[model samples]
Target chain A: MEIADDSKNSKRVVFVTVGTTLFDALVRAVDTQEVRQELYAKGYTHLLIQIGRGSYIPARSTSDNGSVAVEYFTFSSSIAESLRSASLVISHAGSGSIFETLRLRKPLIVVVNEDLMDNHQEELAEELAERKHLFCAHPRTLHQTIASMNLDSLLPYPAGDAKPVSKLINKFLGFPED
Target chain B: MMRENQWLTSMAESNGIAVIVVTVLTLILVRLLYVLNRCGKSLRPTTVKPLSTLIVLGSGGHTAEMINLLLELQKDRFMPRYYVAAATDNMSLQKARTFESSSSSEKGTPAQYMQIYRSREVGQSYLTSVGTTLIAIAHALWLMIKIRPEVILCNGPGTCIPLCAIAFMFKVLGIRWSSIFYVESIARVKRLSLSGLLLYKLGIADQLYVQWPQLQRKYPRSIYVGCLM
Candidate 1:
C-alpha cells in the first residue's frame, strides 16, 4: 500500500510475464498469500507481474509492503528492460517469452497454460525441462515449484548463430563464401 | 437425326477441351519437376555480388524468432535486405526496422520494409477471405518481382506461403532463381505449421529447416537445425 523509495532498487526482483496474451490463472496463483510468502522466504524482495491483457488484476499486498512488494501492469512497450533487471522470471509458456528469458540466461520457470487445447507449449516445456534449460510447472503447482525451486540448476541456453543457417543459404544459392 | 448430330458435336468439343487442358497441365508439371531438380543441384547463380535478401516476418512470435535467428547473419553478405510482413501485423515491421537501425554502424546495406495484405484475417468470413487471398497472392507476386531478392528467408508465417510460392514460380519461369529458405517455428515440436507443410510438401522451399529433432524425424525431408532461437 505504501511505497519505500529508498528500498525500491535494492529489492531482489522476480518478474512474471504473460506475454501478449491473457492468463489470469497464472496471475491468481501468483497473487496468493502462499506464493508471495514462499518467494519472500526465498529472499525475493519484489514480485513484478506483467499481466498483459488479463482481466484479473493482482491485488497489491498491503500487509507485506516491507517484506515482498507486489506490482502489476497490463503492458509495456518493451519487455526487455523489465527482463534485464529481473533476478528470476516466471513466464507463461509462449515461445517468445520463453526464448527471451532463456537468451538472457536467467533462472526461469515456465508455467504451461493447460486451458489452450492441443498446445505445443507442453512439448516445448517438456523438452526444455529435460534439458535443464528452465523449470516447468502448471498454475496449480506453481507455489510448490517456487517453494522448492533451485536457481542453480538451470543451464544457460546457448546463444544461437545465424551464420550456419546463412551459410546453408549461400551454399544453396551457389554463392562463394565471403 | 439433327438432334443426334448436335449432341455428338457438343461431346466432341468437350473432349477437345479436355485434351488441351491435360496437355497444358502435363507441360507445367514437367517444367516444375525440371526446375525442382535443377535447384537441388544448387546451381551457381548468375550474380556474384552480395545477395539481395528477402526476409518475411510474421505476427508476434514468428517475428521474435526471426529477429533472433537473423542476429548473427553475415549482414554484409545478405546486403540490401527487404523485409515483408502482413499489413495487419503492426509490430513486426517495426521490430525489423529497429533491428536494422541498431546494427547500422557496420557495412549494413539499405533495409526496405514492405507490408502486404494478410491472406485472411482472424475471424474473417471464409467467403470473403477468397477475395482477400487472391489480393494477397497478387501482392506477394508483385513484391517478389519488385525485390527480386536472390534469397528468401521466412520462419513460420502465413504470409510466407504466397511469397515462397511465387518465388518458386520465378524458378519455374527461368526468371531469377530466389533460393527459398524456410525455418519452422521452434514452437512446432510435434507437427509442422501449415506454411511449413506446404513449403515442404510442394517442394517450394529449397531448404526447409525444423528446430526440433522430433519434427525432423517426422518430416524426413526437413533438415534439422537445432534451436535457431
Candidate 2:
C-alpha cells in the first residue's frame, strides 16, 4: 500500500532508539545522506534517533530542508512519549525495548548487536520475530531491510500470554489447578 | 502501723500491675506464634482467599521477568496485586501497566502501584547509597504496614533489598503477614547477583527460585523452575 501521497508532505515520524547501550554502528548507518534520501521517499517526514552512549554523532546536514529533518539525541527521558507519537520504531534488540514497543502495538524492526556477551539480544529478537511480534535484522543488513520494508505486509505482533510464568507463580502461591 | 500499711498497699499495687502486664504479654506471644504458623500453612495446598501479592518491579530485565510471571498466573487467584518500584524508575511503572490494564478490564478491584525511593543510583558512592538506603527502608516499612500483603514477590534488584528486609523483619516479629519469595533474574547464569546473594545469606526469603539448574544445585534451597522470560 502507498504510505504517502507524492504531492503531500509526509508527517510520519520514525523513531530509532538504541536503548541505554551504545549502538554507534546503527546510528552511523542511518545518518548517511543516501539512507536519509531513501527514508524521505518512503513517506517518513521526520527521523528521531536516540543514540544513548554511542560515540558517533549524526552530522547535521544544512542542505536537507523540508524532505526529512534528521535529529539525534544522546538520551531521552520520555521514550514512552516518543514511542506513542512514532509511526514506526527501529530499536536495538533489548527485551525492555522489544516488549515496550510490542505492548504499544507499534510496527517495530529490531536490530541485534552481535558484539554483546552471551548473544542474548539475538536470542530475544529471533523469538519475538518467530512469534510475528516484530521483525529482526542484523546490524550488517539493517539499512537494506529498512529500505525494502513493505509496511502493508507487516504482520500484527501477537501478544504472547505469560501462562508458564503464571502457573509457576500459582504453584508457589499454592493455588495450582486441580 | 500506718506507715507499714501504706508500704504494703503500694507493693500490692505494683505487683498487680506486673501480673496484668505478664498476662497481656503471654496472650500476645501466643497470637504471634499462631500468625506465624498460619503464614507457614500457606506453603501447603489449601484454599486461600486469593492472596494479596506485592511484586517488586526492578527496571529493565527484572521488570520483564516479573511481568511474564504475572501473565501466567490466574488474574482472579491473586486479588488486589500491588507493585513497588524505585521512585526514579518510571519505565518499570509503565511496563507494569500492561498487567494493570488487562486486570482492570475485569470485574473486581484494581491493582495498586507504589514507587519507593531508590537506595542508590548505578555507580553511586557507598556513602550516598547508605543515606538513601535509610530513606528507602523507612518508605518500605510504611508500605509493608499499609499493604500487609500475604506474599511479597520479587526478582533480584537493588530496590528490592529494603522491601525484602522489611518482610524479613515482619516475619521475625511474628507479624507473619507477608511471606517473601525471591526469584533470581534470568541474567544470572553462573552465580547469584548481589541482591540474590544478600537475600540468600540473610535467609530473608521463605522460598527462592532460580532460572538455571546450576543455581538450584549450588544454592540447594532455590527451586529450579527453569526460565521465566
Candidate 3:
C-alpha cells in the first residue's frame, strides 16, 4: 500500500472551510505545522483555508520542498466554485457546507464545533460518517482523522431528489397525471 | 295593529336568520369531517385545474433547503407560486425572485413574493412577540384570502406557522381546502423542529415528511421519504 506518494499528483488542493460563523478551533487545528506537513506528505500541494469570522489568522507559508503552499481568506460570495476545484475538503459541519461538498462528490471531512449552539451539527456529521459518506471529527480528533483518512472508502452521497416528494404532493393534491 | 304586525315579522326574520346560521354551521362541520377524513385515510385523487401553490421560505438554511426542494417540483403542476417570507428577511425574497426569474423563462406560472411580519426575532422578548405574532397572523390571513392557494409546501420555518394555521382555518370554515405539506429539515435528527412539531401535534399538515428514519420512528405520523434535498 504505497499510496502515500504517487507521481504526477501535483497541484492537489486541500480546502479547509469554516463556513460563515467563527470556527477558530477548526481554523487553528488545520493551520498547524503538523497538519500541513501531513497534508503535504499525502501529496496535497496547497492548503487553502476560509477562516470565516475567526480571529486566528494563519500566516502564508511554504515548506522547504516548496509544496503545501498555505493561504487563508475571510469569505467568498459563493464557495461552490472553490469547492468544485478542491481535491479534498475539510469543512465545518454546517448543513450548507456539508451538502455542497457532498454534492460535488469530493472527499470530505466534517469537523464539528462543540461550542456552537448544541450537538445538531454533531448529529448530522456523525450520522453521515456512519453511513460512510464522509469523515466526522471533533476539533481535538482532527489531526488523527486527517492522518488515517481513506478517501476511496467514502461513498458518493446520492444526489437528493425532490421529484418524488413533488410527485407525492401532486398525487396528494389529487392531480391526475397528464 | 301595524306595530304588532311589524314585531311579528321582525321575530320571524330573526328566527329565519338563526335557522340559516345553524344549518350553515352544521353543513360546514360535516364538510370539515369529510375533507379531513379523506385526508387522514389516503390521497383522494380528484381533479383541480392548475393547483395554486404557496411556498413559505425561511431565513438561511431553511430557505436554501426549500429552494432545493422547489427546483425538482413539477413547474406546470404548481402554478402561480406565491412565496412568503418574513418581513425582515430581504435576502430570502431576493433569492426567491432570482429563482422565479430563472424558472419563469421556462413554461411555468409567474412567482409572486410577499412578506409577513416576522412574528418573533431570534432574541426578541416573548411579550413583544405576541403583538407581532398577531400582526403576522393577520397578514397571513389577508394573504391566504387573497391568494387562496390550493397547496402549501413549507419546511422548518417560523413564518410558515401563521400561514399554515390560516390555511387550516380555511379548511375548517369550508371556505377553501388547501393541503398543507410540512417537510422537517434534514438538520433535525432525533426530534422535530418547533414548526414541524406544531404542524404534527395539531394535525394541521396534511402530510409531514421527515428525512431521517429515526424521526419517522419517533413520530409515527410522519412519512419517511429519505433525504429530500
Candidate that scores best on TM-score: 1
How do all models score by TM-score? Answer: 0.85, 0.61, 0.82
lDDT of 2 by residue, A1-178 (tens): 2223333534677899999768887888778766677777777778889999999998655335645777888887899999987877889977678778777877788988876644555755775566566778876777677788766665655454445445555665677575
Please give the lDDT score for candidate 3: 0.83
- lDDT tens digits by residue: candidate 1, B1-229: 9999999999999999999999999988998889888654575654467788999999877898788778867677787999999998889999998999887786536899999989876446668878898999998988888988888899987788888888888888778787788989888888998788988888888888888888999999888887777
- lDDT of candidate 2 at residue B214, scale 0 to 100: 71
- Give DockQ per model, in order: 0.49, 0.20, 0.41
lDDT of each: 0.83, 0.75, 0.83
Against the correct fold, how does model 3 do in TM-score? 0.82
| Residue-wise C-alpha lDDT for candidate 3, range B154-180, written one tens digit per residue | 998788999988888787877887888
Error of 2 at B25 (Å): 16
Q: List the candidates ranked by TM-score, beginning with the highest.
A: 1, 3, 2
The sequence of per-residue lDDT tens digits that candidate 1 reaches over residues A1-178 is 0112233456688899988879999999999888888888877888899998999998775336546888889999879989888887999988888988887777889999988744767788878888888899999899899999776677778866656676676677666767
RMSD of 2: 9.1
- Which residue segments of model 3 deviate by more than 4 Å? A1-7, A62-67, B1-44, B105-108, B120-135
Instruction: Write model 2 residue lDDT over B12-114, tens digit each, in one string.
Output: 9999999999998897777656654454234667546788888899878788888787766666767678989989888898888866786566665658889
Q: Rank the candidates by lDDT, best first.
A: 1, 3, 2
* Candidate 1 whole-model C-alpha lDDT, 0 to 1: 0.83
